[model samples]
Target: MVDDDDLILEVAQMSLEVVGGWEVTTANGARDGLVRARAEHPDAIVLDVMMPGMDGPTAAQALKADPETADIPIVLLTAKVQSADRDRFADLPVAGVLAKPFDPMRLPAELGSLLGWT
Candidate 1:
């Protein structure tokens, strides 16, 4: 998972670890997340939309544009839940989206369904 907010990261980590039973690696920013993604080649990525430098869309675009990482599933987490905002991501190679203030308890199942893992 990658997010600028420290609390979100911590909470997400705990939820995924304890409830989802998944070993998660987190990054504070897009750059670090990309680096880790390349190294770890994780099954999926949960990315925050708004960040200081590279936002989720841009990072996702970069990841998709790269042949090495293009196939990795990406899930965008955003506070922008507007219809238009959701439509804007239609063309991107994203696996799914989760609205902000999400239910941590259901996150793993939601992502798994999106990624077609279940």
Candidate 2:
């Protein structure tokens, strides 16, 4: 998971680990997220849309452009939920877009469904 907010990261980490029963690695921003995604090669990536220095869509482009990390599915987390706001990211190379202030416990299930996970 990648987000600028420490509280979001902490809560997401716990939710993913405990409730979702998934191994999670978090990055504080898009740059760190790229590095970690390259190194960790996790099953999926959860990215924040409004981060500083390389936002989620840009990061997703970078990930898609790189051969090493190109195959990893990206799910964007954004505070912008309006249709117009969501449409802004429609062209991005991401698996799905999830809203912020999410139900922490349901996050994994929702993400899994998006990715066709059992």
Best by lDDT: 2
- Cα misplacement distance, residue 55 of candidate 1 (Å): 0.4
TM-score of every candidate: 0.96, 0.97
Candidate 1: misplaced stretches above 4 Å? none
Angstrom error at residue 75, model 2: 0.1
Check candidate 1 and list the clashing pairs. Answer: none
Query: Which tens-of-lDDT digit does each residue in 6-56 have in candidate 1?
Result: 999999999889888999999999999999988989888999999999999
lDDT of each: 0.91, 0.92
Score candidate 2 by lDDT. Answer: 0.92
In angstroms, the error of model 2 at 11 is 0.7
What C-alpha root-mean-square deviation, in Å, does candidate 1 show against the real structure?
Answer: 0.9
Q: Positional deviation of 110 in candidate 1, in angstroms?
A: 1.1
Question: lDDT tens string, model 2, 13-99?
Answer: 998899899999999999999999999899999999999888989999999999999999999999998999878888888989888
